[model samples]
Target: MAIKNVVVAGGSGALGTPIVNELVKSGFNVTVLSREGSTTTQPAGTTVKHVDYKSVDSLKAAIAGQDAVVSVLGSFAIPEQIPLAQAAFAPGSTIKRFIPSEFGVNTRKTPGSAIGKILGAKTQLVDFLTEEANKNPNFKWTGISNGHFFDWGLSRGLFGLDREKRTAKIYDSGNERFQASNLPFVAKAVSAVLQKADTPDDKTANQYFEIASFTPTQNEVLAAAEELTGGDKWTVNRVSSAEVQKVAEDKLSKGDYSVFVDLLSVWQYADGAGHAPNLADPALGNNILGLGHQDVKESVAAWLKE
Candidate 1:
């Protein structure tokens, strides 16, 4: 079935905004489901519905008539998805596709050592949606796994990098290659998936559609950063991902829920280790999704300036 009308939950977010913009650009009728009292602005030609996220009836009303539903809600808000999905698959609903917030690693199949705890809600939601889709023929689900957010993550210090100081806690010799995607490319990939929603050979449905901007090792990323901002200005400290993981585990075991330690635990999978099993795959969704590559140097350079 052709997906024309799309509803996006959390369309006001950093990632959701771009996806909403791309959907509008792709000629889909866009609607954003925002909680009442939200003040975020949406793109032109987009309709914003302020509704109660807790109520299934409210969510159903917001989702009604949408051909596709995209949930870009934050990780913590994953429980909200259960009701949202139920409302989408409600009787007489027009929703055909559901894209949950599986925007990072293939957490369902390869939940990395540290990120697994973080991915609990998402993993459970995936199973819930998969079973829901199986029960409803008219409903299908697509999950986009782009590994880590490269440009945005770096800018936000998600990569253990202090962007301003040009200092990094390099993981495992800085040579472990893993998949990553730039923010805009992620939006483009989502647009591409919606565009192809009509085709019978759609590889995205009920599957984890994985894509990447470039798979680079920590050392490669450091080289790029150094080239952008001379080596003398940058400092690097090498540490084993396993060690970081051990520390993180110990902290968490002792009931320390510090964000830093949690992030370090998640980095264990990304840090040049074999923890992430699917990072080495070459047959990404880029070709089938008609996505062109963004120059890594250019992206990194731009991000550094930000």
Candidate 2:
């Protein structure tokens, strides 16, 4: 069934807003369910229904005629998705696709590893969705595991380069390739997936799709920053990928959960020379979902204020 009349939970959030906008732009009938006291306005022309998120019946009422429910809820509200999922695939519900908030690193890749344990909540949700999809013949779940948010990372210095600080942290030659997606690319990718729901040759019923805007090295990103900020104006800090874990582990021993990000960075920047878990090619999903590609410098430009 081609997905239409879609429902987006947490449609007012950072990632959620863009996904909602793109779905509406792609001509999908978009409905954003706001909480009872939400004062934020959704995108123009979107149908906003304020409902009880705690009650499954209220969720069912809002999701009654929808074809898909894309949950972009933040970390704190993840548990609420159980009720949303229950309402989506209920015995006679119209929803055929349920997409969990999986826009970060591949959580399904490592459940036994440290980062996997830290992200257990997210992976568990996917597991639940999978079981539900198996139980219901008409229902299926889709997961998009894009590595990182490229533009956001650049702007916020998550990839180890602070634009305002005029410094770049170079990790082990700084040329290890990691795939990532920007807000726009991720949004359009979701829209495309929903639009192509269960088509003959482009079936997206129960597939977990991996995608990225571009797979660029840190060196490429640094080059873009250096170019945008004049001839290598930024100070560079050289660091060994091998030493990253010790520092992360030390922090983890202190009960700092923020170390999870450090551990994830270890895999993305250091493990197998940056190719950890060694999964198959992501091009298959990108091709199927029509994500195409973009230049990394373009993304760097936005963050560098160039």
Candidate 3:
């Protein structure tokens, strides 16, 4: 029940790197599960095992002695988690905890919505986790939903704000509040979850621990950016969330996956797309996870400097 040895899949990715680093800093025995021939170098103070994700037996063997498994697999490989989960729950398997990549939206409970459609693979894996956990009482799963990636996404121009250009695509009057988290903060939250699970009761098991640096509207972010870089230097273009949704849906029909970001915009900033449902419940452990608040100004400052 005490989680000391942890194995992380996709340990070289954007999100996985931070989680692995934080786990190392937290003094957990870390193992990274890479593909059969990954040439990527892993972080220091961690072990690496090359295994075929296609082979459940290989994955099970690689993670045989791990106390917990944390998955940071990309969206395209989301279905790959099902076999990994099965391997974890196999007879004689020692893995007690499984953390799937639920970092973005809360898609486990919204399979019927538009953003759900965009992130259907996440729902599929969640369903598999649910069934597996029900079959084995000792096996538990944890999800960390922090809405959107504020720092990473903003740096990559995914948050509608171009850090270099000083321009923003303000969606729908720029007043829709939503959840957001920085990379390091969410990484620390992962460490907190594992520490909480390193106990007899394990309160973090089978739960989606929601945490955020801060939740801010698009306009609020713009104001912060303007204050950092002067209002006159920044250009703003108001966009309709409904219109973006329409375009995203059309692209989805054509198998254009890039429209997924636009679909998320529909849910995050639109009027009736159920934005930030996790924030509705304050009882959820944000502070309990040792996650502290960060202002939008700080986020803007970081992104602008990046």
Query: Best candidate per TM-score, number?
Result: 3
Which window of ten consecutive residues has the lowest lDDT sum in model 2? 271-280
**lDDT values, one for every candidate:** 0.78, 0.81, 0.82
Tens digits of per-residue lDDT for model 1, 1-306: 378999999898888988998888888999999999988888889999998878899998888778999999987688898889888889988888899988877776545455566567888889999998889877888888887778778777777677777788776666667678887899999888887875777877787777888767777777887888865546887676666667777776676657443453345334445433343445567766878566677877888888
The TM-scores, one per candidate, come to 0.91, 0.92, 0.94
Tens digit of per-residue lDDT, candidate 3, span 263-295:
887677775445554443554557666566777
Q: Sort by lDDT, best first: what order?
A: 3, 2, 1
Write down the worst ten-residue block by lDDT for model 1: 268-277
RMSD of 2: 2.4
Q: Which of candidates 2 and 3 reaches a greater lDDT?
A: 3
RMSDs, each prediction?
2.5, 2.4, 1.8
Which candidate number maximizes lDDT?
3
Candidate 2 C-alpha lDDT tens digits along 205-225: 777877878777778788888
Looking at model 2, residue 176 earns an lDDT score of 79
Reference-based TM-score, model 3: 0.94
